[model samples]
Target chain A: MQWLHAVPWDLLLIQTINGIVTGMILALVASGLTLIFGIMDVVNFAHGEFLMLGAYIAVLTIVATHNFWLALIIASLGTGLIGALVYVTTLRPLLGRDPLTTILATFGVSLVLQNYALWQFGPVARKIPEPFSGSITLFHLDYSLYRLMIAGLSAAIIGGFWLFLKFGTWGIWIRATTQDRIMAQAMGIPVPWVLAGVFAIGSAMAGASGVLFGPLVGVDHAMGFDWILRAFIVVVVGGMGSLGGSVLAAIFISLLEAYSSLWVSPAQAGIISFVVLILTLLFRPTGLFVATPK
Target chain B: MTLKDLDKGQVTRRRVLAASGIGLGAAVLSPMPLRYALAQSKPYRIGSEQPLTGVAALGGKTALVGLQMAVDRINKAGGILGRAVELIVADDESKPDSGRRKVEKLVTEDNIDAHVGGYLSNICLACVPVFTENQVVNMISVCLDTTLTTSKCNKYTFRPYDFAPSQAKAFAPHLVNKMGKRWFIAYADYSWGQSTRDAYANEIKGNGGSVVGTLGIPLGTADMTPFLSKISGDFDGLFLIFFGPDSINFVNQGTDLGLRKKYKWAGDGAVAVASQLPALGDKIEGFVGVDRYVPVFDPPLDTPYLHAFYDEAVERLKKAGLENAAPDRYVQSNFEAMNALKLGIEKSKFQGRADSEKLIAALEGLEMKESADFPTGDKLLRKEDHQAFVRETIFEMREGKYHLLDTIPWQKSEVPPACTFA
Candidate 1:
């Protein structure tokens, strides 16, 4: 009871806000990963490298253009092209082969991308230009303006994506292909082009999130590995191929991290994602929000 | 045998007979022994291994530059013991198992006489037992875990720079006496961080100061807001033990959140590294830290030897076309360790393990005075634990540069007493 009274309420409030912002950015990255996996049935081990490339593009573009918003768009488009190139040159040929082969190929591609980034940018970490700096007081609580802006931008993009998936023509085609590729092909849909489009869209989302996170954590060749791991965990705990589940699981994981660090040490909090992942596998293999196929 | 015959490239009977007679005489004299003797007189090799890839690649490359600079100088001075010095380098990629395997190969197959390595603590710890088993003289350059010199110290290993305990001890008195008595600590959650936290806590207690709070931050933590929000109070200063990229993130975020205005800051030398100063800009101004070396220092402490070495190192880096190369603490520590190794080998006339015992004996309790080699002034190699005691500085960052505030002369520690070497 005494320890309960000793809790810092103000600190708790700030961490809760931080947790939401973290989850929002995570969902932005995880959405692309889950979408690609759902449609193509190919797990991208190099998805994190796409994020790293996006960060580098953002930083370089900002340095050249001196406009954060323009840099973000250019970086997204640039990474999308690279993602499409990867699919056409490497992944397209591996279609109809064993899934394990594609997995190993992507893993190899991850190593190559990491080393290329190291060679191109050198080992020093860098930061993207801040769209906005400092903090804002909301409801008498101080929150970082950069974080809040990122959260808002992420929500808008995610919401827009959800709307497209629900009503857009290309979105309907992608959904139909994801459900039944053979039937979609028989229905006169270009399955290969749809798969390529899905991969490009997913990579573009990852790139945008990476650029957004650049100001918060800085950019390094190794940053993608950590982000991709967390994104994978989010997608797994949310149930693969389930968009709504991804958002919930991402927020849940972020909250677990925030509160766990408040109560336990930060070191222990780092393992919470893996711990939740193991527990979910042991008990409910389909995840909390995942729907069962009847 | 005539000059005209040789020029014409003609093999006359007389020329052939004369050449055969000379060759037979030379063979009979048995020149094979002389050829073998010359082959055996090759330069002594020092195998240098560090993670040249992965996250720790920058530090490893910087340390290698320092070692290479020392090697070039020693070779130019007509070598040591009439034998030129050679440095062979390998990358461990920041993996402990990789470090062990590389060191084993260097010692067994490459026939390297001695070794100097390992930028990260875990990698250094992994190579310790291998060095012990092989009886190879190992010079530690960068890793700062105290256990390497105390509980884990071996007859074959020597640490030439300040460890975690000594660094914390040197900084504690300044924080308690001048700054204030109440302190907060934010340390990385690992062996290096744990040891630093323990050392500072003990020192603070010993000096009548009290720790208000302590937070164990995970390494590579991208977000520091949650951790920083928890720290609130009247603590005079915050002690940071984070390193590399994490240090940059913490300082940038912590300052933005008004923690910089609230408290004085102190930490390891990573806080004011040259590479990070531009990114951090004026955010880390007024920060103080304890370090092995700094390129800029107070006028009084600037010895002529220090200036000459710094100038030469900078020139060498420029000549090699390395833009980011600067003589930071990591470079200086490795440079100093290489100099110590050179002195030990020359004094003992080292050949191999059979002669390494003598080299180790020669280095024990060796005091080096201020000279071209000993740029940091007088240093003592403590006979007890084989750790060098050198002068350390407490400097404050002002105007985007580190200005030395105070100096602790001949800083020594036997904090857990001497290693048993059991």
Candidate 2:
């Protein structure tokens, strides 16, 4: 009873909000990575490098234009083009080959991209100035305005992506290609073009994630390494091909991380997330949302 | 003899004249003397391994710049023992295994005469055995774990940087006497952070202050809101035990949360280090912490020796287009370490392994006098631990620059007596 009385309700409320915001931001990045894996059957080991490149592009854009929205557009489109270039140059040849070859090739691409960034930008950390200042008060607790805006914008973008997939011509073509590539080709759909478009869209989302989180996270060459690990955990715990599943998993895991910090050390709290992942793998290999194969 | 006769038959009168001309050319250009040949041969290589790719890459690059400057200065003055010095650098990527491999390559493949490491205690700790096996002198800079100078202390390893316990002990007086008694600690959850937090905790307890709460943050953590939000107890100050970008993220978020406005802040002065402080600008004002060196000390109070070195360093930095290169602890430590190496080599008249042993003996307990090269007054190297004893400065951030508040004289007893080396 005394311990219950010692609880800081305001702090808990703030952390809960933080967890949700972090989850949404993470979902934006993970959704792209999962989408790429689902449609192409090719795991992009360089997905984290794309995020890093996006952050760097955002840094340049913000410094030059001083407009966050312009930075986002340029960063996303720039990174999207780079992603398509990577697929054409590296991934296309190995598409029908052994998956191991493609995986190693992507890993090599990751190293090249990381070292290239290191060479070009050096290792210093640069922060994107927050467009807005101060915090918004909700439930008598003040939350950072930039963080709240990121959450709101991330939710909107993710919602917009779902609607696009449901109605847009290119989005429908991408889905058809993903469901059955040979059949989609038989239906006179250009499978290769649709696949390329999906990859571009996925890469764009990852780029936008980087730009949105840049002000909060501090942009650096290796900033994407840790985020990519969390993104992987999110996709794994969610059904790999399921869009709704990844978002839900990200939120669930982030909430656990936030609430656990109140009781245990942050490192230990991180371990708890991995534990949940391992337990999910053991009990249901296909994840929470994926139906067990007969 | 038959073959020589056959070759002689092929040498005609024109060939003889041509051979004579070639001999003159060779004498004039190529084979001047054995001395010239030795001069153009291998230089005295000093190897350095640092995190050139990962999160701590900024610190690594800064330390390398300081080392390169020191080498250039030494080489300009006819080099060490009249032989030019060469620096062989390898990227460790902030990984201990990579550090070990790089050290092994430096000592074995490059055949480095001496080496230095910057940042990441785990990486430094990993390279310990590599140094021992190769019998190379490793001047460690910016890795603050006390065990390096205590239980893990070795003849091959010498630390020019201040350890965690010494810095904590030096700053304890101000934290307890001036600031309020209650404190909350937020620390990164690695070797350096854990050790630093422990050192501070002991100091606070010994000084009759109590801690209200403590939180551990993982490495590469971008968000600090979860930890900051939980600081609900009645604490007078917040002690941050983080380094590099992690430190930057914490301070930025802590300010946004208005925690800095509410509570007095104290931690490692490295939280506002050279490359990092400029980014934060005025936000770090009013914060105080302990530092190994602060280049902002002015004339009269600061030694003439220090001022002269500062002027030279600033000019060099400007010429290199590093206009923002301020003399933080990392740069100073590596610069000091390079000078100390030169001093040791000159004193002992280095020859080879036997002379390296003699150099180690000469360096142990060496009392360095204040000079243009060593501008930070007198420094002592304790024979038992090979830990450099330099005065610690407590600096407060004022007007976006560090102002030296007080200087703590070196106390031998401040560092715990060493245990036997493994």
Candidate 3:
């Protein structure tokens, strides 16, 4: 009771908002990565590069147009097109090869893309202006309205993607491919095209998250690096290829990290996520969010 | 027939001609400058390891430019000790392991006489041992971790620029008097940041101010807002210790969370490097910080040398695709560090790695004058700690330009040496 009384309630309230907002952004990024792995069985080491590409596209788009929405749309479309081209040119030929081949190929691709971004953009970080500049009082701090908008926008995007994966015809094809690629191909589902389309969608989602996140941090070549690691954690913890699980795990992990900051230092708090990852792997190999088999 | 062809003592005309031709070809093929090869044959091989394509690539690229500029200048002035200085560079890829490996190669394989580079502190710390083991002089360019000259100081390594404690000593009075009394410190949560934070905190306390709280955000933490959201309550100002993209990220996110409006913002000069200002836009307005060098042509720094250095740097940076970017501290410090090595070599008459002791002794109390080589200012590299205390300039950002506020002399900013060389 004494320890509870000493706890800063205001900090708790503030961290809740922080956790939720941060979780939504993480979920958006993880959704694309998990979606790709789920459908294609290709663990894209280049997923982060796609995210970086989206932010770079958004930077150019915003600079020319000064419209955040236009930038978001253009960046998503641009990254999606690039993703499709990547699939056809690189990933397609190595589809039936050993899993290690695809992994190495994507790793090679990541290096090329990262170096290319460094060469093209140089090392200086770029800026993307937020559309809204308003804030609301939240405890002792006045939080930026743009942060809340990012959370809301991410949710909306994820929600719309969920709907597409549920009822839409193309969504059925993707689900069918995820379940049985051979049967889907036999059923005249255009398996190769579906795979290409799924990659584009996954890449588009990554781009959207990148643009949304650009305003919070400098748009640099390595910006995607920091997020993609955590996204991998979220994917593994939520059950890889489980979009629903990834979303749930993202929020849970973020909240845990947020709450841990109260009792421990940030470096210690940061370690809790990795600890959780290790524990889950040891105890529940199927992932904490996945349904265990009887 | 074999014994006749092997003839060790035979001095036939054909054999002599063949031997002479082989010797001439070998001399011509040698990497040493042909003119210098005539007088003093061996070149002084200098190696630099930098994060050429990783997280710290921006500063690393700029640092390389400065080092090259110095080497070019040294060579143009008829080389050091009448021997041409050859520079060998290795890319560390911004990882400690890679940095150490590169340094090992630079030492054993390249057989470099000296080294002059480091951008990231951890990478620098990792490679310090390689330099020590090989008995090579290391002129650290831009790594500002306090322990480099303190607990972790080595005989082989020397930081020829300002570090955290001195910067803190120079700026804490201004921060306490002009800014607010109670402060919250946020830092990059790494080797450099943690050391810098402690230095500032101690200085602030010494100056009759209070450090209300401190937060250390892990390097490359995607969103600092979560960590920043924890920063609230009674704090008069927010002091930041970060560099590169981390600086831009923290400022952007912290401002987004209204921390900017709530508290007076001040930090390490790295937060507002000239290249990063365009990205920061108007957000950096009114932020006060301290640095040894800023790319402004003000009094004391308005010399013709600085102008020449600035013009060439600007043109080079433009060619490197950082168009219109002013040379940052990385560029300034690296240029000076290399030049300092040249001066040391010239004074010691150092030839190669065998003369490391002589070079170290000469550089111990070396005085650097304000020239193209040391365009920032005059300073002395302390014999005790191998750290130079340069004049610290406190400046404020106004319309994305650094406006000089005050300057603290090297004598005033110098802290007591705390290093014991092994």
DockQ of all candidate complexes? 0.40, 0.43, 0.79
What DockQ does predicted model 2 obtain?
0.43
lDDT (tens digit, per residue) of candidate 1 on B1-422: 66887888897888798899997786677686654345347888899888777767656767777788888888898777667888888889777888889988988888888987778787888898887888889998898877888888888889877787777777788889988899999987777777778888988888889999999877667767667767777788888887766787788778766778779898888767665565565777999988768877477567898898788777765554345455777767788888898889878878766677898998888777788887877888877898887777888999988798887776543354458776
Off by over 4 Å in 3: A1-4, B1-14, B17-39
For every model shown, the clashing-pair count is: 0, 0, 0
Q: Which of the CAPRI classes, incorrect, acceptable, medium or high, describes model 1?
A: acceptable
> iRMS value of model 3?
1.1
Report each candidate's C-alpha RMSD, comma-separated, in the order given: 4.3, 5.2, 3.9
lDDT of 2 at B275: 67
Candidate 2 — which residues are off by over 4 angstroms?
A1-12, A136-142, B1-42, B297-323, B411-416
Which 10 consecutive positions of candidate 1 chain B have the poorest summed lDDT?
Answer: B317-326
TM-score of each: 0.90, 0.90, 0.95
lDDT of every predicted structure (CA atoms): 0.81, 0.80, 0.90
Summing lDDT over every window of 10 consecutive residues in candidate 3 chain A, give the lowest-scoring window: A261-270
Identify the candidate with maximal TM-score.
3
